[model samples]
Target: MQAEGRAPGVREVAAAAGVSRQTVSRVLNDHASIRPETRARVLAAMEELDFRPNRAARMLTTARSRTIGVLASSASSLFGPASSIDAVEDAAREVGYAVTVAHAASLEPFDLGAALDHLRAQAVEGVVVIAPQQRVQDAMAHLALTVPSVTLHGAGDAADEGVFVDQLRGARLATRHLLERGHRRIAHLAGPGDWSEARARREGFLAEMEAAGADAVVSREGDWTAASGAEIGAELVADASITAVFASNDQLALGVLHAARLAGRDVPGDLAVVGFDDIPEAAFFAPPLTTVRQEFAELGRRCVARLVALIEGGDLAFEEPVAPVLVVRESS
Candidate 1:
């Protein structure tokens, strides 16, 4: 797929489809009078030339772009962000809206601001933010926002805005599962401090630990990577008092499992391990894994529905809360 030259415009699309410019325009705008055969021809031409209709140009007359822009902190390979993004796209398409994603080059404020500006330049009617960092949320509050927007997160709180997946409840569930198994001195392998999800999860863990009157073994700061977890776990092994672990994510739990093995500790015997975010491969991990599962698809759909409602001037307080489930497995 190499570029021939400048992108094909409406004229080129019309010529390729062997239709009049008016016919091509009608097809692009989804006019009620356009014939199905002609519309198919135009769509085929668009596919062949990789042509995309310019929403900004069309908005000149209708003042409606029928598009939503997404501002993500970064396009990380993490499953939670990736899955939620996919769900948002699917849900937006179902409601006849196109999605435009602008991912920050980094998690820095400068990159986030640049990504927001780029999305704004596209003239999107509304925007959805998928960045869950506290700093990003702070940045959003200061901006004199001119567009209706929604943000999806895992903070586990009912707010005046945003859709959350109840990270606190999930963390408590994970911690309780360990406690029920008669394990004491439970350890918490937390994620990055700046992330709202990480903070919420740690809060839940600490609360549960204190509630149970158990000594808390909080690990060092983690970056939500297996390598970081392994590094932290290596240190955690030296603590003979710690008997259970709840990692903020599955990857970290996997590292803890490895660390336990190296130290000749048996899972569910010497140490019970649990994780959050029941990723697909969790079931197949060496001894399986106990995890907390958030409804990412429902979270995504609700986010789009909320943002669209905001754009359409309908009910902005629908308040569809997404709950998390605890999946019990062998490791715990």
Candidate 2:
């Protein structure tokens, strides 16, 4: 047979490499049963000929597009969904899968259903929803998709396969750290009530304060923004009795830091401040804020792994609550 100056076909490559066409197929498909040496040989031959596998043909044969869908909230949020997206993409690529991202920013009840339906129509093998807000969780609670689905930051009843960091534990750590620093009157600058993270942190702070036999000052709700943090921080400063404050997130904590400077209160000298999320800026805050570090990337990777297992009909167990670490810095 006369071979043209084109990339070799699988059969030609297999013949050249002294392997069966089926062996080449298995190697290209990344089947684990093939011997490593055999796979190396097939891969070398294909490389020598610059042969590229036809993705369309492969998808048709396998009935899989080799893609997973990630449904998350606003992509603009650096701390949560955005971090998760990066982690999922990195982990999926490591396992030979591609990721498609869908943002459910509004997460309206109807919109949540529509988003899931849309991802399903795209032929995704599985879907992951990163729902931190209670409304988003409620929206997902009514979904009955047979396609394997997992939720991140979901409440107790959204999905059986859910992943969440221990926000309560994080709060306790932040509050306890301040208490150890000799701050008796501690207040909370909480995130919006709609968010599960914020609520969990509030509960954790309350629990730790009651356990320490210290007075629990009323919490001021912030919208997880620097402006809200500044506003609430000023209020706490005006009260004259609050000596320590725990902000739900780093952004808000930055605002609190600013408010403290404006009020001429020396951090850890006149007042102590702690925050959560331990964002990159947290380490560079004026006094290098003490905070809790939530492993956003790890959470994302685990969520995808569990969803993929469910999609593949594999028996997998849900992971227990992930722990958050307290990062000690100059702020406290």
Candidate 3:
């Protein structure tokens, strides 16, 4: 039994398990040659004693930090980026790696470089860049990285490290949903121009409209805020010919809903709306929003897995771009 108010250690665990210190070490490291019964005994003893191997000691001996660095933008509070960070942390925990985050104040090259310097000081084994803006990507392209890295947003090129969602495909799915419902004249409330996601979504909407030979009204651009959406929505509702609207994100859709109500327009009857991101608040809106759902959980898992592969010098398996799904609701 452990002494009162004292934490248990490996020596006590080995003694309780009737094994040598070397055997306990082998068990902790998951040595393939250890007998199953011996491993089970060591684990049982560890559980009984509440013993945890010292991560710092392990790093010192193995010369591996077992940590991942997340380089994020100041917009980490936003739903998409916040969820991505959470998912990355969960996936890394599952793989026995800790995560350290560094937030850049802006997309400026100096800010990004400072953030990278912070992560480097932590001795992170790999990096996951979570900023979705094009300028950030361009800045990172020029920076020299000493460790392997993966990005959550990009064109999924070889340089992107095979970690991305198909934003264009998701946008097409949202646009097609409105089109199939007989909305010929549609408008798009796009996000900020600097965001790669916004550009892809706008392009997808255009492509889908052209393919269907429908009127594609490229409406005003918004800042991915409900206020911008509402401002754009007021103008959009002015044109009664525009029967449906596809927004770059759910927040914009919410703004549109608000504007439609103020204008006495009936959703689905006078106007249909589709959104992207499928944020949590999207479902509880006055009329539940019909939106495209980005598979953020899968994206995080893939990012960590790809980073791990790069760090370990393993085969880089080419994965297909993460697909998005259309969620139907009363709003559309």
Task: Return the candidate ranking by TM-score, descending.
Answer: 3, 2, 1
User: lDDT of each structure?
Assistant: 0.85, 0.80, 0.90
Better of 2 and 3 by lDDT: 3
Candidate 1, backbone clash total:
0
Q: What C-alpha lDDT does candidate 1 achieve relative to the native structure?
A: 0.85
- Tens-digit lDDT track for model 3 on 156-245? 566655477788999899889889999999999989898888899999999999999999998778988999999999999989999999
Reference-based lDDT, residue 47, model 1: 96
* Candidate 1 ranges with C-alpha deviation above 4 Å: 1-61, 157-162, 318-320
Query: Which window of 10 residues has the lowest lDDT sum in candidate 3?
Result: 155-164
lDDT tens digits, residue span 1-332, model 2: 32776656888888879999999989888899999899999999998877878766778878887778877765336576677678778888877677887776466877777777778777788887777777787778787776777777753333444477878888998899988888789999988898888888899999999999997785657888899899988988776789888888899889889999999998878888898988888889899999999887777667777877877788555656667899999988
Which candidate achieves the best TM-score against the true structure?
A: 3
Off by over 4 Å in 3: 1-4
Candidate 1 residue-wise lDDT, 1-332, digit = tens: 23477788888888889999888888878899998998999999999988877777878757898989888877445878888888899999999898999998887777878888988887888988887778788877776568998877748555624477888888999999999889878899989898889998999999998999988888888988888888898788668788889999999999988888888888868888899999999998878999999888888778888888989888565454578899999998
Candidate 1, after superposition: displacement of residue 267 in Å?
A: 1.8
Minimum summed lDDT over a 10-residue window in model 2 is located at 154-163
In model 2, the runs with Cα more than 4 Å from the true position are 1-22, 45-55, 155-162
For candidate 2, what is the lDDT? 0.80
